[model samples]
Target: MLQFKLVLLGDSSVGKSSIVHRFVKDSFDELRESTIGAAFLSQTIKIKAEEQEEDVVIKFEIWDTAGQERYKSLAPMYYRNANAALVVYDLTQKDSLVKARSWVEELKNKVGDEDLVIFLVGNKLDLCEGEEDLRAVDTSEAKAYAEEQNLLFTEVSAKTGQGVKEVFRSIGEKLYASKKDEILAKKNRELGNRVNNSVDINAQRPSTNDTTTCCS
Candidate 1:
């Protein structure tokens, strides 16, 4: 089983905790309490590899951080070794998207891992359902930014459990693929070393059939 540290970041009341709750518990609360410092949760998912017929078990160690300004300083601590991050924004709030972009920038700078998968998520789809005017943030705009920043982007409603499962599933698939690549690279390196060592040993071995006659 492979374990990955994942973190959620966004502005206050952007539904970061709600999304995490929905993904983990498969339920939602209308009056979900705000997260304090950070909430810890874990979920194990089984994903099938695309190329091979094998099931990969991925356990996500989720850190749902507080979105308030006071907790902004502590964000780095939670995401220090995070393999992936979900930068969420509320669909009803335009400023929330701005905050989400900032969080993405911070993660890129602080995490500094090129392989770290960052997702730009728009939450609160329930609020905008059937009321396009209620959406303050444009989907095309968010998606354009995500594309420019090379991020995974999606819109989900935690309340109705819409697009919630796909978010985690995508992350699992990407993480599993990365792990597989790493393992293959390591094995290749080990094989190369063994071949080099064998060559060295053969070169050092003395010739068994020395045919020089000393006294003819």
Candidate 2:
């Protein structure tokens, strides 16, 4: 069992808790409270690597960080030594994208180019298709940024469990591969490089705009 801490960061209503619930409990609730500091959960995702079965017991450390601007500066503390982070955004709301971008920017600056695995999630996919399309943050824009940052990106609907499994599954694989390389190479620099290559954010989607954004 590999112990990895995965933090979730985004605006309060962006569905960070919902995604964690679906991935960890395999269930969803319409009414859920915004996380104050963080909550920890353990999930065992089976990932096969190098023809051997590996148990990826990610701590699934769902840090439903406070979205209040006052609490914003404290985000870095949660991610300080985390293995991965899930930066979520409400697909139906463009303002959430801006907040997500800022979070990504901070992570990029603090964690260095070679460390930290980021899962750029566009949440509320189920709510995206019906009401509006005038200036929705194109999923592609997030994908492009993830690609540049060498992070993973996905569209998820926490309500329906769509893309929920894939998100955890992929992150688990990357983290596992990283641990294996680091263990075998016996060098921190090499380990970071190997892990960085494991991420192909470009492998995911499609294109961008001046997405409206807000941390509150």
Residue 120 error, candidate 1, Å: 0.4
Off by over 4 Å in 2: 53-59, 130-135, 184-216
Top candidate when judged by lDDT against the true structure: 1
Please list the C-alpha lDDT of all candidates, in the order they appear: 0.86, 0.75
Candidate 1: 10-residue stretch with minimal lDDT: 202-211
Report the C-alpha lDDT of model 2 over 172-198, residue by residue, as the tens digit: 888777677654443354447568887
What's the CA error at residue 110 for candidate 2, in Å?
1.5
User: How do all models score by TM-score?
Assistant: 0.84, 0.76
lDDT of 1: 0.86
For residues 1-216, write the lDDT of model 1, one tens digit per residue: 568889999999999999999999998999988899999999988888766567767778899999999988888999898899999999999999999989988888888788899989999998887755589998999999999999999999999999988999999888777778775565466668678765433223322222223554
